[model samples]
Target: MDFRFQSASPASWADVAADALVVVVTSQTQRKLEGALATLLKEAVAQGDFEFKAGRTLYMHRAAGVKAVRLVWVAAADESPKAARAAFAAAFGALKQGGTRHVAVAAAWEAGWQPAQAEALAAAAAEAAYVYRHTKPSAPKPAAWTKITVLGEKAEAKGVQEGLTRGAAISAGVTFARELANRPGNHCTPTVLAEEARALAEEYGLKVEVLDRKAVEKLGMGAFLAVARGSEEPLRFIVLRYDGAPRSKAPIVLVGKGITFDTGGISIKPAAEMDEMKFDMGGAASVLGTFRAIAELKPKLNLVGLIPACENMPDGKAVKPGDVVTSLSGQTIEILNTDAEGRLILCDALTYAERFKPAAVIDIATLTGACVIALGHHRSGLFSPDDELAAALQASGDKALDPCWRMPLDEEYDEALKSNFADVANVGGRAAGSVTAAMFLRKFTGKYRWAHLDIAGSAWKGGPAKGATGRPVPLLTHYLLDTAAAPSRA
Candidate 1:
């Protein structure tokens, strides 16, 4: 969909010749409404209707003197950023439901809304209108909106326009991430993921390389291979590099744990809800999604994305509990539980990342259920020994509204991974499971400043609204943008 900004007054918005004119209505906006629109809104409110509450919407059809077919009033409980995003989503939803082909949003920027908020609003609207029907029979098409015009003061036009552009790119990235995660494991195996990565690289003119099982073994990725051995699907270590900066620049490396379908191998998971393991690759999806955005935005920074794509199944060839495997970093690991396989694959990937001599490395994974229990579905668990990197990530999360709560990565947690037979143990018992998992990955990332995002919580949802949330893509993208915008390090 196309998005643009126009300079227009709220009273003049009705005459814009659009299918619908959407006006955000807050308690302040209710008193600020003037002329014919005010009278109509006041009358609607007087009739025990259109109370201003966050995300509430009231549609007026063919209102007197309004040229547009409908007027959409989206309520905002307060001027908070979250409320603004919710309001925009509600307004767009109203437009979609009313089958409005082209619409104008007369957003009340007077109510403490910044340009970034405007950008977020537009992005939220795009995201809300997204639907995934990849495998289902095609349904009758709904009336699609061809364009969205954000009506604002002349002074705000440039900022709003820039925001709209950035927001659209971010939203598209998010949607791509969701699509990758939503696919069934059968349809999106390790080989399929490599194909998708190659396609993305080709489309964006980025460098792409896919290392097959033989190449991965040649690199001594025993930890990753152990996890892949159980599955018939060929393992792929996919790398996508984007060098928007000079060759001398040190790149930021993102390592993603892509367990396409985790059946928990030897130490199997319960039968119930095991289907959701298709989403185990959420971290990899987010990385690819971030790549999609940066490719469009073209940030002036070198970036490298690594995805260790494979499956973990309970086949006879699967790695069993107490099995010892060597990692790409030459560290040996005693597998205490086959279910704790995310870190196993991630360890080898993170180890391989050292080849880039990255300034910083961040590995994203749906690694531990303990993270889900600790942070619930709201925030991801962040762990890093580097303070500067953690601070940058936290700030990015705040700006994107995709938050993470930092978890400890002390030597105490490292003690939990002690192994009698190997250099480290894969599972570190039940206590502080999330921290132990981070500690396990931390060992391989010693060559560079690194952080780990345990996204087991925020990757996807369960129940009736079950689907991928497309998280950390926003967080990671924002961080890259900020990094690119900053002055070069000496």
Candidate 2:
């Protein structure tokens, strides 16, 4: 999608050229708009054609005194940041039904608009315009709308433009992640995901490497390989590097659990809603998504992405409960439950990240349904031993509106992983399942400042709106952008 900011005064808003014009009312109650349309909006409220309630909107097609073919009036309580985001979201939701290819938005709080408001508007437009039709070839084509114009005060044009650029980049990354995660398991295997990474590297000039099973065996990634034994599809350990800074600078490394399709391997999940297991790779998708955004924005910092891509399926060769496997770090893990496989793959990947000599490393995964129970579907569960890293991530999530809640990682939780035969048990008992899973990965992250994001709750929706949310992409991107602006770590 293309985004632009136009400095249009209130009086000239009605004359802005576009297929549709969306006007936001900052006043608590609906009142007159600017110019000839001032009384027109008041009359709209008086006639009950439009309600004065927040988020209420009125849509008019070929309305009188409007140069545009269509006009939309949306109500907001105020021009506050929260209101701005909600108002734009409502405006775009209303526009979704129309074929407005070129949209003109005349905003009120928009007069004093900041970058946040601009970013909100652009991101909302992308959300409204998105339609998934990749696997469904016969699905209807998306709307022809390709351009979004936000009418802002002349004084704030530069800031608003900057915001639009960021929003466009973020939304694009989110869309990419969603598309990859939405694919069926057959079409989106580990090999396919590696190819996607290779394509991204080629397009963005990032260094890319795809390691096959034999290559992985050489590195002694026993835990990662044990999970891949059940699947007929070959596994691929993907490594991506974006070097935008000097080699001496320690990069921020991101480790993503790449369970392409999880059937729980021998400890197969219940038949109910099993289809959603295909989304087990949401963490990997988010990493790819964040990379795309960073590549476009070109933040002045080095970034490394590691994905231990594979599938967990039931087979005679599958690793079973009580089996012990050694990790790349040479730590042995007893598989108490084969279903608890995300941490198994992630643990090796986390060990692999140590080679980067990263300043900080974060691992993203759809690690546990326990996380979904703890945080519900609203926030991803964050676990970190480092307080500063935890605080930075939480703040970043808040700023981007992709919120996360930090869960306790106290040493007491580490007791759950105590193993009878190995250094640790892959699955702890039912109590504090999510925390224990984080604890398991925490074992391998001893060499770096590490944080873990359990995205099971926020990664995808299970019902009618069932699909990937492309979360953490927004959160991660914002975090990296903030890091790039700060002084280099010593």
Candidate 3:
């Protein structure tokens, strides 16, 4: 989708045309407004009988307010455009419910609020208005909404506009990741996932490095390689780097579990929707999508993404229960259940990332079904050793509206993975299953401040598949941007 922004004077708003219409107005009751669009709206209200309730959207035969653009109301505050856009979206969403297709917004001018900020609010509202449209074969086409005009003053609002643009672009990237997650195993394989990553790299400015099966073997990624033995297709480890910050900036590292399809190897999964294994690589797609956004935003932060892409098929060569494998970090892992494949691949990748001496490391994965059972679909499970790092991520997620809930990473969870044959066991019984999985990955993180995001429930579309919901891309982007904007240890 393409986005465009235009700047025009208040009088030019009347000529602004669109399919759906939103007329900015003062309060529905008799109240003289004294904010940004005060003069223009005061004059327009006296000239006509237009009714605008706080939460209601009214259609206009002629453009109302100073700009003559479709208008929404901000009660009194001069810097109330953000609130006004919210009102506009509420009314506009209602119009869509009422069968309206397109919407044009006209706003009353504000002296206090920067136009850029107002535009950002407008873009945010529009982006939030997004509804997944991939499912429902008979669903109606979405109505077109193209233009938004703010009335009154025309000061430079470049900063606000840039923010809104960044948010919307990052949202688009998240949706891309979700789409990959929603695909069926038959349609999305490790090979295919690599292709998708390459495409994204080409479109953005990120650098891509892919290590094939032989290369992975040479690197001694035995645990990851063991999991890949089940699939006929060769495996590939994808590494992406985006450095927009000064060369001196410490690079932040992101790792993802790219199990494109998981049939549980020798420990076969239940028959029900095993096909949905296509989404197993949702974590990899997410970080890749995030890199796309970071490339565009050009934040002054050094970053690297590690994705170990493979399929967990149940073939003769597949690693079976009781198998022991060594990781790139020189740690041995006992395979208690072949189904626990995500961590196997991710452990090696995390060990690999330690070479960069990253300022911080974050790994995302659909690692355990137990996570879904624990958090349901409401939130992703966050596990981190560093409190400050966890707090920053949680705060960033909250601001981006992609919330995360912290999961414990006490030594108790680590003990669960204790293995008689190896340093650790891949599966840690049914109790605290998610935490144990996180613990297994922690062994490879070394001294880096690491956080694990188990996106089992958040990675795909649960309710309906109108399109991919793109769960945590925005949250991850928000976190990265925050870190890039301000340096923090751990």
Candidate 4:
């Protein structure tokens, strides 16, 4: 949505919006806005149906003398911008970011907003809501809602609602991502996953392409197919594309691992807490959810999502330890362990990423237990070769309250993954398991500025028997928006 300020008479502005916030300062109170107020710097006790209770909100309809929407930040006579923005964000469910309040005033219009701008407002607002819900340690002061008044005509109401609607859409996407991450492997199989993706695409306008066993084989995704061979259900590779951006620009590529169920193949994962393996596909779900947001907001940034969906079960056809498989990139991998299947699927997906030649490639997976050990459940591990891409993503996460910790991709770890039988080994031993896993995938990224997010701890957090955590959706969506809005770089 295009956001701008206008200097119009109260009569003209009132003609635009039916209900508007009026500012008025009364008595000994400082400057404040009252409902469709008469005075610009008057402080008056909040009255009418719109009461200003501590930590709650009320709305007001347009009244005489009101020129534009005014948000009343009721603080203890003296409140800082931080406190005011917090209250304001909570009241309207807006993300606390620069230009949000100003942009939102105009964005509230019922129409005249581009899909991208509309979605950005929603994404930002949803992010704010998520952060508010997660923050703790309340202060001993009264809270107040920040009010926003619409000053445009009825035509602008659509734009305003559109901004709010976008926020809801992003929330839905994040919720879905969290759900997939939290589900157990027994319930989230390949068939069930295919059903989920198809349902979302059918419900939304997004396009989905699910590649079955034969199709996966045709693509020469042997590494991914090998991981699924052990399972009874056939493997599926799902591709979702949303083209809201210009076709000339390279689309943002999101690759996720959709391991419906992982039993560590023939190498076999430990029996303890195998149930959590269901969330192994958290990466795929995140990409799916992100695509959902893109489709809803219709951002002018082309997005392509790839999911190498499968299960790593230990059965007759399951690829065993010491097995050799060729990735789509033609690089061979020596399977040192069946439990290290995430890298196998990711390698081929990275190779598949070559098809799109994306401006950047981001892949998320619950690939290692060591990552959880390192960062715990508070943050996901972010490993990226590009500083610019990494910084943009980190900033996005900060705004969304989905924080991440940057992990080192030390060249020293690469030696642990060397394989005599193939170009690389899937497992890099016990020490630095997470870093080694990243190194294994880095070999496939080639020249692309790639980021590998290890969501193992963030995806599922409980005791030994914890459920899926459904993490990183908001962060990814935020990053996409930031990248889309940034100026094109060479």
Candidate 5:
């Protein structure tokens, strides 16, 4: 969608010619006050039998004296961030439902919206308008509105333009992530994901490398190979480097688990909703999505994206229960369950990240179902050994509105992962399963500062709205942007 910014007020609706004009109203009585558009909106609110409440939207068709085809009034609860986001989403949703082709937004400044808030508004609009029809036999109907104009005061033009640019980048990233995750397992295999990464690199002028099975075997990635051995498709160790800073600077490394189709291997999951396992590669998708945004924004920081992409299928060659495998780091893991395979591939990737001597490493994975039980679908579970990194991530999540609850990663949780045959056991029983998974990966990340995002809960939804949510992308992007804005490290 195309977004344009205009320095206009609600009273100038007479001059704005569009399919729809959206204005914000704080409360029911606010419409009855002053302003030319206010009087018209008050009349419409009284005659059209509409109530003005937070997130409530009322529409009028070709209202008298208004040049637009429709006028929409969006209720704002207050000036708070959450309310503003909801209000924008509601207004955009209403416009979409009304089948308005072009829209003009005149409510962004109502709650004293700043650049950040404006960014949030545009992001929310893009998210609300997103629809996935890739699997359909034919393309879905075209979107009603192809362009959006945000009306702002003259003084806010620069900030609004910056916000719009940032918002568009983020929205595109989120949509890309969702598209990758929503594809069927057959269509979005490990090789396909690597190709997508390569395309992204080429388009954005980033450096790209794909390590095939032969190269992977040469590097002694036994843990990663164990998971890949079960699949007919070739494994791809995908790496994307964005060097916005000098080569001497230590980059931020991001490791993602790329299990394209997790069938739980020998330790199989139940047949019910098993198809949704295609979303198991959400972490990898988010990493690629973040790279898309970073390439567009060109944040002044070097970044490395590492994805251990493979499928986990059940086969005679698949790693069975009680199999012990040596990782690239020379750390042996006793795999009590093949279903716990995300960490297996990720552990080796984390070890490979050490070669970069990165200042920080963050791994994103749909690693555990237990995390869903712990945090549900509302928030992602964050685990980090370093308090500073944890605080930074939490702050980023909060600002982006993609919240994550910090989970405990105490040494005590490591007791459950002890194994007599190997250095560690893959599964740590049913108790604190999520924490144990983090602890298992923690062993390979000792060389660099690391954090783990257990996105099992927030990666996708179930039932009617069953699709990838493109989560934690906002959080990761915000963190990187904030890091880029900070003083350069020596």
Candidate 6:
């Protein structure tokens, strides 16, 4: 969908041509409404038909005074960007299944209203309208929702326009990630993922390199290759570079764990919901998603993405429990359980990131169920020894409304990975599983400033709303933008 800003008076809202005119309401909303719309809202308030409570909504079809086919009034918690996002999303979601093709959104015009509010609205609308139909041949056709016009003062066009552009890009990235992650294991294998990366490279002029098994083997990625042995599908070590800045500048490196379908190998999970394991590559999806957005924005900073894509299945050739493998960092790992495969691939990828001489390295993975238990579905688990890096990520997550809860990464947690045979153990028992997983990856990241995002829960929902959340993409994008806008480091 496309979004733009236009000047429209409150009285003129009655004459606007649209399928739906969404009026955003805050605590001070009543006083801002004008003409027939004001009278309509006042009557609704007096008759107890509507209130300015958050999430409360009122929908009218061809209301007596409005030219639009429908009018949607949604109450935001406040004028804040986050609230606006949720409220706008709710409004659009109400119309997603309907015939509403064009929407006109108007909020109280304030002198100091940040464009972030407009950005929030654009993102929320796009996300709400997204419907997956790639593999569903019998599924209904895509929604006709096309253009979104934000009613604003003419003086505020430039800033709001920029925000809308960014929001659209972010939403597109989120949608792309969701589509890739939503695909079944058979449709979205490691090789298919590499093809998708190449497609993105062609479209955006990015530098993409997909390493086959032989290439990965040549690179000495035993930990990564071990995970691919169980599946018939080939493994791909995909690398993406966005040269927005000069080669003289060091780039931020993103490492993603791409377990296409995890059957737990020798240690299989319960059969009840093993199908959900297709989402094990949520991290890889987010990496690709963030790349999609940054490549579009072309922020003034170089960035690189690494995805160790494969499947974890049970086979005669599969790496078994108690198997020891050498990582790209030359460190040996004792695989206590084949189920702990995300870290195995990620360890090798983290080591590869060191070659970039990166400003910072962040590895995202659905590495631990413990994280789901710890943070629930609300926040991703963030673990970092570097306070500055962790703080920056935390701030970015907050700004993007994709929050992360920082976990402990003290030396005490590292002790859990003690191995009797190898240098480190793959599984750190049951206690503090998330932290131990981070600690295991930290072994390979010692060469650079690194952080870890354990997106076990935040990656996707499990029950009724089972789909990829396209997290960390927003957080990572915000972090990149902030990093670019920040003063150059000496």
Question: What is the clash count for each candidate, in the order shown?
Answer: 0, 2, 19, 33, 0, 0
Which residue pairs does candidate 1 place in steric collision? none
User: Model 6 segments beyond 4 Å from truth?
Assistant: 109-113, 487-490
Candidate 2: tens digits of C-alpha lDDT, residues 6-77: 988777888888999998885643333577568678788779898757898888888778899988888887
> Which residue runs of candidate 2 sit more than 4 Å off their true CA positions?
29-32, 488-490
Location of the lowest summed lDDT over 10 successive residues in candidate 2:
27-36
Give the per-residue lDDT digits (tens) of candidate 5, residues 263-365.
9999999999999999999999999999998899999899999999999999889999999999999999999999999999999999999999998999999
| Deviating ranges (above 4 Å) for candidate 3 | 1-16, 23-103, 106-156
Local lDDT at 47 for model 3: 66
> lDDT for every model?
0.87, 0.89, 0.73, 0.67, 0.87, 0.89
lDDT of 6 at 330: 90
For residues 1-490, what per-residue lDDT tens digits would candidate 1 score against the true structure? 7888888876686677888888887787566666777888788778977877788888889988788898888887776667788888888777776578788877654553366777777677767677777776593354477688888778788888877877788888898899999999998998889999999999999999999998998999999999999999999999999999998899999998899999899899999999999999999999999999999899899999999999999888989899999998999999999999999999999988988989889999999999998999999999999888899999889888889999998897878899999999998889999999999999888789999999999999988888998888989988999899883420
What is model 5's C-alpha RMSD? Answer: 1.8
Identify the runs in model 4 with alpha carbons over 4 angstroms from their true place. Answer: 1-166, 184-186, 463-467, 487-490
Q: Could you tell which candidate, 2 or 5, scores higher by TM-score?
A: 2
The TM-score of candidate 4 is: 0.70
How high is each candidate's TM-score?
Answer: 0.97, 0.97, 0.81, 0.70, 0.96, 0.98
Name the weakest run of 10 consecutive residues (lDDT summed) in model 1.
106-115
Mind giving the per-residue lDDT tens digits that candidate 6 earns over 1-490? 8798888777787789988999988767668788888888889889999888988888989898899999998998888888888898888877877888899998864442357887798788877777778788886656668999988767778888888988888888988889999999999999999999999999999999999999999999999999899999999999999999889899999999999999999999999888899999999999999999999998999999999999999999999999999988898989999999999999999989989999999999988999999999999999999988999999989988889989998898877899899999998879999988888888888888999999999998888888888887899998999899993430
Task: Tell me the deviation in Å of residue 251 in model 1.
Answer: 0.6
